[model samples]
Target: MKEYLDLCQRIINEGKWIKNKRTGVRCLTIINAEFEYNVRDNQFPIITTRKGFYKSAIAELLGYLRGYDNAAQFREIGCNTWNDNANKNQDWLNNPYRKDKDDMGRIYGIQGRSWQRPNGSKFDQLKKIINNLKRGIDDRAEIITFFNPGEIEMGCLRPCMHTHTFSLLGETLYLTSYQRSCDVPLGLNFNQIHCFVLLMLMARFTNYIPGKAYHKIVNAHIYENQLPLLCNIQLKRKPFQSPSLIINPKIKKLEDIETWVSVDDFIIQGYRHHGAIKYPFTI
Candidate 1:
């Protein structure tokens, strides 16, 4: 989408270079920035500048909604994105809180679907949102937050796309996704897809039409190793028209998503883009 291309170009032109301590890599970083996607026009925000893996993106999102806390579960769902962080991260492997093999601890879907309370009770954030939406309630608190302060030490990595707030206006649904940190080259590609598709799915089960998706980024950066690729290769390409997402009409309820949805159930039409650019990913 143009918005993605613009954000990338803005980072290239305006970002400041800094040495990131976590990955020991240089980053072209920028401060607060935002973008929006119009779901009402059926705009699927997969990056057209380079080959975007819609299936992996969708799978990751689905795995989160299913409350998966294991990397094996994500792999079963056709997403190996968590493999590196879950199994290969030496820091997490050595941490005392790290559980058995392939455990991601309490992060993302684990926190979103079953957040733990001080009383040792579990709170289902996703279920609550769906239930409230079903009752046509727009109480300005339809939020699903994956950032758990208490469990940060237990997880392999903190959530970048941490919170999502859904708003209802009449019969239309809109979403605003918040991110604390963003790896512009690698993470943002999948993130845009996640935000737009998330709104689409939420609207589907809640009896509302998808309206728009907004992404708010607090710290957006392109890794120094990835700058050459984004500037010389990926960013040089032209973006095609935004594609349309096709979800299974058979998905009639929220529970159906947990047991019935797969990558095959989602399709994207008219997606034409440049070949894949293997930008360097840091854990």
Candidate 2:
């Protein structure tokens, strides 16, 4: 978890100010940051400095895995993380592609689950990856990507953590995720857990041992309003040890994950941390 703290300090120490019109706030921004999680040891990359929302983060990932494109669906699964972006973002609210209330247009899950094809058919990237990995086959291209530049204008928001690539070496599974932009103070906490759990779940269903989850960030930034709390309070506190994650073995297939998986199926062990530090989310 010291790596997480180091990132925060790095932003405070070395970041440059950049004006962002979307949130109407300046940001301390940097580029090309990286983090690697030791999934084989179950050393979960949860933020131990604050009361982390591991369940909610898992639930959000589940919604994407289920191909849910609506915020309401996420809420029904005990994840309210999308409510703000769905209904509150003025740009999305004004976009004509927005179907109705709670419509997330064709963002993360939609792109991952049913990436549109050029010939009028649909492609299931996740299904293909799962099936291939299950058979101990990694064609060196087991990728599920949600970065559709053609449909970017139609989605609620452009995909940030856009691509997830899986690799297999013998019986071990490894994952690498790439993101173009990040709201470090708020989003990174959840994303680390998301990637770690994604690798764990993929390993479980594919009969592969979890290896590691690598995360790459292109532009990492803390909004001006978020910098004070992150740099002054959260960074000042010491981080506890990384926690361990356990997932139910019942999730043996992609269908199992899409059909009946709940956040309750995942549990955290030995998660000791300081009190919660509430940070304002940038829309």
Candidate 3:
């Protein structure tokens, strides 16, 4: 993925130093960067510059599709990404809505699948999109959104990759994902895999050929603590060719995805990459 590597380089060369409020860390930041992955061509955008944790990424997506709100649920699916963000936030720890230490509140998948309503009801956004696709009903708004402004306080962390809009052209399906903020060194690696897998799974269940997955990023930044690993070590290496994602064709329905899909159901082919880099992450 030359685009990803180039973006990293561009951030170092052109980004300005800025202080981030959440992590209290300085960042070399930029704005409004965009990229696309050609799913039809099997161009999986896993980073070859550093070892990518693709399994954890897909598992995290599955947890969201299942509408889970607990960090324990994500860990059961082999993703520890939410462990820190969920339990470590003192505000969330003190909030009454937090059911237990593992509770993630109303972030990501919880919001996408079971967005809470004021009357204590839940709306299933992913189901609606699937039903629309099944009926061939394109009203120009086949969208799945996880940005719940009203419940921002209820959630442990606000979603970065917020909205995803799916469009159809004949038998081909295209996806456009929007992210409001990104930590390029750590977050972008997983985010890319999530987008690619989302498009593939959506296309598979909806009976459409996967076309392209476009990612739009706003306020992309590399944390100052991660600059040494990213710019000095990671960026200096050349990236290998993009990997291809393999999904089980037997997954004929959306229910299959929600009910019984495992991490093994999704596979990466020919992924040759550099060793993993432990980029610093702060909640």
Candidate 4:
């Protein structure tokens, strides 16, 4: 984690910030790394330094994972992370077409489905591979894909280019995800951590081998503007800590945990008043 913090600081001290329409205003650059790994726990991955941004990020990530494209469900849950980007003219409250609406071209269902193709090709392919594996099938054709070339015109966020390769070694299942681009300052750290969490959950529910996940970032790039923030973050004396977990006494089955994944609340409630801290460093 110190290494990660150092890298973030380097980017901020040396990188330049630029604005881009796709990611709103951003700072972009390339980051070369030798290794990357994943870790899992019952709670969502978020840094809890200076009031964490865990809630909104978790809500957004879950919303995407559960196939809920619109903000209705989020709003109902007292989470409005996606409202900032909604079409102003559209009445989000009464729109039945809300579900049909696409974010940049990605529909909620598209992401939820194991495969992107309509005839269930993705699931079909996965099943075929699974059956083959059970029957001693050792073919390279067992891969599942998420990107859809045809949907490019529909305005979806380009499918997460990262792909996961699943393999079974003895009784354990192993997965590796390849991400080409990562927005370090604004979102990369959390995204990488949460995506791994999702992958682990999927493997658990599907009864796949409970194994470690390997994340590989290809052409891994970082935004320049985020560098300063990243540097500032590293300069702080304390590293972020996970919130304490507590169980609900009334509901024996339910555990209550304060999530720190959302960035919206952190920005509004935490960062607004705190002045930036300075640390000695040189490019």
C-alpha lDDT of residue 106 in model 3 = 85
Q: What are the per-residue Cα lDDT tens digits for candidate 2 across 3-90?
A: 7888888888899999988888899999889999999999988888788989999999999998999999999998998898899999
Off by over 4 Å in 4: 10-26, 31-35, 38-45, 48-51, 55-58, 74-81, 85-104, 107-144, 219-227, 240-283
What is the TM-score of each predicted model, taking all chains together?
0.98, 0.98, 0.97, 0.60
Error of 3 at 254 (Å): 1.9
lDDT of 1 by residue, 164-280 (tens): 999999999999999999998898978988999899989988999999999999999999888888889987788888889998899878787799789999999998888998987
- Lowest summed lDDT across 10 adjacent residues in model 2 is found at 227-236
lDDT, model 3, position 230? 80
Candidate 1 segments whose C-alpha is farther than 4 A from its true place: none
Give all candidates' CA lDDT scores. 0.91, 0.90, 0.89, 0.45
lDDT top scorer? 1
Question: Which stretches of model 2 miss by more than 4 angstroms?
Answer: none
TM-score, candidate number 3: 0.97
Tell me the deviation in Å of residue 229 in model 4. 3.4
Model 4 agreement with the true structure over 1-283: per-residue lDDT tens digits: 4445555565555555555555554554544532344333333234433333445555555555444555565564444644544433234323443444333224433443444557646543344444555554446555544455665444234444345566666655566666665555444555555454445444443445445666655433455444455445535646544332221222111011123222232222222212333221211
Ranking by lDDT: 1, 2, 3, 4
